[model samples]
Target: MNSSVITPIGKILNARDLGKLVRDLREKQGATQADLANFAQTGQRFIVDLEGGKATVRFDKVLQVLNILGVELTATRRK
Candidate 1:
């Protein structure tokens, strides 16, 4: 897995963009929603909702899902 390709998420200005990112990464890893939910210890509905850009998703669960997908979130000051 190339770190650079996964690291720069470009301009993720909203939830729909975030959802698309998750969906793309999941598909690249050959994983199903159920697989991701089980790995993240979340309900399948959560996965569905997350990928559908549900506005009220839990951040903690989002972190868990990202972890299960082998991705990490980073914070840095804007240049």
Candidate 2:
């Protein structure tokens, strides 16, 4: 279960991009929104909003979901 995605920085330029990644990873693992929410200790509505790319989503929860989905986001200076 070592699935991952490698996209150029520009490809994921917004919350929507990040959400797509999360949704993809979640689906890849055959996980339902409820499953992810339970693992992240949050409500299923939170998962819905997170996966829907709602800009106001909580940062801490976003990190938690990413952690559970085995996704890591990094920051780097553009060339």
Per-candidate TM-scores read 0.84, 0.83
Q: Tell me the deviation in Å of residue 1 in model 2.
A: 18
Residue 10: error of model 1 in Å?
2.7
Compared with the true structure, the alpha-carbon lDDT of candidate 1 equals: 0.88
Q: After superposition, how far is residue 55 of candidate 2 from its true place, in Å?
A: 0.3
Per-residue C-alpha lDDT of model 1 across residues 1-79, encoded as one tens digit per residue: 7646655766666788878889999999999999999999999999999999988899999999989887788766878
Off by over 4 Å in 2: 1-10
Best by the TM-score measure: 1
Output the worst ten-in-a-row residue range by lDDT, candidate 1.
2-11
Q: For model 2, where is the 10-residue window of minimal lDDT?
A: 1-10
Residue 75 lDDT in candidate 1? 69
TM-score for candidate 1, please give it.
0.84
Residue by residue across 1-79, what tens digits does model 2's lDDT show? Answer: 4345465434577788888888888999999999999998989999999889898999999999989987677787778
Q: Considering every candidate listed, which one attains the maximal lDDT? A: 1
